[model samples]
Target: MTDTTDPRHAHREEGFPAQQQDQPGLTDETRPDPDHGESTYRGHGRLQGRRALITGGDSGIGRAVAIAYAREGADVAIVHLPEEQKDADDTLALVRAEGRTALSLAGDVRDEDFATRVVTETRSALGGLDILVLNAAYQHDIDGFESLSTERMRRVFDTNLIGMLFTARAAFPHLEPGASMIVTASVQAYQPSPGLIDYAMTKAAQVAFVKALAEEAGPRGVRVNAVAPGPIWTPLIPATGWDAERLATFGEDTPLGRAGQPSELAGAYVYLASDDASYTSGAVLPVTGGKHL
Candidate 1:
């Protein structure tokens, strides 16, 4: 799988199927299924006694991280929308199956005030927060600037950028030097798609925030970083409103020849959260199937 040239092609023969759904797409409906490492991920107790809070943990990269964290011996609290309860339940079951504590909190990240509340509730539920994963985001494709609406732009900025700021700030009081904050950035931040201008802006802003926050939070031993993914197949894709053709051939242009699976991404977060990454701060790790950052 590390060959970086479609080593996962056996799984890619099916490709990431072309599909569409309303915002916050459901995982059960996604074709070929997304691999969250359920039967494959083996734990090594890397995160024993750690407590974490991950946004959008009901599915996609967030869900994969949640499963990996729990298997690594960390208790987890996942924040998701009320409408995503079904998916949340599935994730919760997997965590508890690992003998790790799990909490599913429902709320909208764009609520502004909800960010602090989400952190507060997670800390209280898990006893403390050493790992904060700001993995939730909002994105949509547009034909061009003309199709981009002020409302859509505002929603994107509010959810993708403002929410990260609010959640990270709220978790500071609960974090110590060994704590890690991992934001879910995108390669799109560095290589912008004309159709994704607004979404890309927020992602680039996230990279800047990570660098600055790492410096400021260093004295306290709290590291800030981000994972920039390329075309990983997740519910977010179809939910982003991509057309049929774009959806069908997604990630084929990458050197890998196909999109990445969610399972392929869990290790980066695990490393960042574990003591293994003690000195790794303010770095943006790209997991784009060999795509350049």
Candidate 2:
């Protein structure tokens, strides 16, 4: 690859220390700092008066979306695991800094009851649910088929797929006409990474679910869509069981020869969640820095 990256933000090495965190990572401790639009995002009221709930909004792409949505004038609620309180607090602060209503709700999507409670509380607190960003995911890599334990596989499916199903079902009742449901699928869905079979399967299933939901929800004036991103610099990358070498050169194989920043993806999310995309549904918007779907 020629590395034809822009200079000011050229494809230089992302300055993150080669290290890993627990299953769901934290943003504050990351080196080189994954940009979550903290300093530079400029919004123009695309989502004015909207109310939204985002899962995994404690950090990374979810945090970026929350920040962008708040800047665009939406009341936002974010869901995170109890252990991720610090990241959730940071996300809440960032949203509040935009002078918008912000709430941080902590719960595990793996529990159906918890998902329902989160949705109900979000609607009550935020007034109503105009947008749903289902982005929380679990990915623990295995060497191959043999190393994959059955217990691990089931856990992945529960957290990554069944949880989404539960949350979406709970949120559907609160979603009114002209609402939007944007999911976070991934390039791994179409690309199918061998080591990440469980994660990839859930991602591919999400794309299909979105297309089906778009059809089912269209008559109700609700739009369903997804974003499939290539390698992006985020806390999750470090926690995904990659070795130090792979972690050091993450996203280098992409045509852009660099990993994407979480902030870089905020625009696609904002557009999909905004009225500007009222006619856009059942689409997978790929922000892969030149990678094809």
Candidate 3:
């Protein structure tokens, strides 16, 4: 007898069904009301007067955070890859629509020199930086370790980890008391998957980096934190080659039974970058639907 199951389909059987969860009304399309006075949220002025620079701010969780920060009264500088200029422009539009200043910069985070330039330009354009969000990442899956090429593995580490370090180093001097640094980690950091070994390893490094850097920067009143998001519905999914069925079933295996949306995790970033989390440092906040909890 011959087997007919697709290699991709084989993985689907290991996961559960997707569940539907009701989400809050805010979205990319909703216009922010300036005079609403934080009535829309339980917290007010969490990041007031703060100036933030967010890498990968063109889309996904980055875009969501940019909008949320503006609503909370912060100016934003969004850094994006060259190929994502349109998304960057859209994000800037949303920030301006929120009645806050927005700067859109295009470059790759993998280059240390470019990372430094981004920091300089952002400060000149935004006046200064109080919060830094290192949210950019890249990954490509391989079936087995033997099949993974050195080039692919290097690219994964360069984007997910090395670039993050460069961004942080470049922004360190500009960050002062009450400022915060937030990095986007993933659930795979704690719960590894064979197919995404390289990506998972880099995420694990990010968790470690956050803790170590927090201690080093604590004396200066700068806080460092990370957000470990589980499967979320982002463009990276379809762009990375997931089929309709696989994409539809994304995040189903977790206890929540559904993938989270980008908007769902934005508040956590806002809180970490705000004064409300003053005593919170060297911590990793898992937005993973109770996974590994």
Candidate with maximal lDDT = 1
Candidates ranked, most accurate by lDDT first? 1, 2, 3
TM-score of each: 0.96, 0.95, 0.85
lDDT winner, 1 or 3: 1
- Residues 1-293 of candidate 3: C-alpha lDDT, one tens digit per residue: 79684322322223322322211112232212111112333336677788999998877788888888988889999988876777788788878977889998888888999877888988898889999999998766576789988997898899889888998998998898998999999998999888789989999999999999999999999999999998866555544434446656677777767666677688899989988899999999998866972
The numbered model that scores best in TM-score is 1
Return whichever of 1 and 2 wins on TM-score.
1
lDDT measured at residue 187 in model 3 versus the true structure, 0 to 100: 91
lDDT tens string, model 2, 1-293?
78584732554455345887777888866666888888989999999999999999999999999999999999899999999999999999999988999998888999999987888898889788999999998888789778998887887888878999999999887688989999999998999888899889999999999999999999999999999989888888888888878777788778777788998899999999988898999999998877788
Model 1: lDDT of residue 216:
89
Off by over 4 Å in 1: 1-10
Q: Rate the local accuracy (lDDT) of all candidates.
A: 0.90, 0.88, 0.78
Best of the two (2, 3) by TM-score: 2
Q: Model 2 reaches what TM-score against the true structure?
A: 0.95
The sequence of per-residue lDDT tens digits that candidate 1 reaches over residues 1-293 is 45564365735644555688888888987876788888888999999999999999999999999999999999999999899999999999999999999999998988878888988888888898999999999898988888899998998998899887888888887788799999999999999998899999999999999999999899998999999999988888888888878888888878778888899899999999988999999999999877898
Candidate ranking (TM-score, best to worst) = 1, 2, 3
State the lDDT at 42 in candidate 2: 94
Cα lDDT for residue 19, candidate 2: 85
lDDT of 3 at 51: 92
